[model samples]
Target chain A: AQSVSQHNHHVILSEAASLELGCNYSYGGTVNLFWYVQYPGQHLQLLLKYFSGDPLVKGIKGFEAEFIKSKFSFNLRKPSVQWSDTAEYFCAVNRRTGFQKLVFGTGTRLLVSP
Target chain B: GAGVSQSPRYKVAKRGQDVALRCDPISGHVSLFWYQQALGQGPEFLTYFQNEAQLDKSGLPSDRFFAERPEGSVSTLKIQRTQQEDSAVYLCASSLDGGVSQPQHFGDGTRLSIL
Candidate 1:
């Protein structure tokens, strides 16, 4: 079955720490990738998405993700994380055709301590 | 409303009871989706609707689960004879179209607890 995987279940970091949350998908066809963030008591929000273009895409709040097709990976990254960045992050993908339903990975919980 | 909206932010029901969860997508959104999110896990797709048509129900786990988008604007998910394993947060999302690239807007979700 097709699935998305996030190797890190939980991560802790101090303020200003660089961050990288790994995401890998098991699909062989063309796909669109996305990163979503959910703060405490909030709904999921789109951080960024990669359809087709430059492999690296930047999103709001200084977040970015690189889509490495050869590796079937689209890892999220941030140069410096703030305490306010603590939240759950999910990586998702969908086929480039047919129903556009997303298949999401088990999310990574990030705690950025001050 | 400006975003996708789901009703009954929380619901508690005994096992075997029937429950209905409602969702109101953005006025102009052409695509709607339903997902079930278990604790400590990401949301899993349950169903999809394009306007008034039910394009896909493949993600539904059992025959007891039913979803409808009768008029194309509002949608509902009905679970008959719910089981303890049915307890999860039900999320609703909508996008401008069924396009491969449209970003979906999600609601806060309705947390369902089956006792």
Candidate 2:
């Protein structure tokens, strides 16, 4: 079975601190990468996604992710994070063809202190 | 437009009881999905439906789990003889289409607790 690996289980950061969450997948086939964020008591929301375009993809709230096919990684990054940015981030993937059932990593919990 | 809506934000059932959760996807969405998220774990795919057709049931953990989308809009996930391990949040997501390009939108999952 294909699986996603999120190396960072939990991360603590102060306001304005940089953020980077590592994500790697075991699937070698063509895949669609996505980042989803869930704030406290909120449903998961789309952060960014990588398809067939440029590797560096920007998403809402000043978040971005770079898709590296050779490495089978799509890592999420932010130049500066705020207290409001504290949430659980998930890395997901699905095949480019056929059923679009997402395979998700365990998730990285980000805590930003002001 | 309203996002996906799930009924019974929280549910509690006895170990041998049965429970049902509901999901109403965004209007006109062509795809609906069910996922189970255990504590401290990411959501895992349980089933997928395209319109009224159930195209994939491979992810379902067991035959005790059943899902249906009779009219192709609303979906229901039911589990029989719930066990302690069945305690988790049940999430429902929908996409405009069942294609790779469309991102799935999730609802506030139904947190189920089996006693």
Docking class of 2: high
State the lDDT of candidate 1 residue by residue for B1-115, as single tens digits.
4788999999999999999999999899999999999998999999999999999999999999999999999999999999999999999999999888899999999999999
Worst 10 residues of 2 chain B by lDDT: B96-105
Q: Please provide the root mean square deviation of candidate 2 (C-alpha atoms, Å).
A: 0.7
lDDT of 1 at A48: 98
lDDT of 2 at B64: 91
TM-score of each: 0.98, 0.99
In candidate 2 the C-alpha lDDT for residue A65 amounts to 94
Q: Runs in model 1 with CA error above 4 Å?
A: none
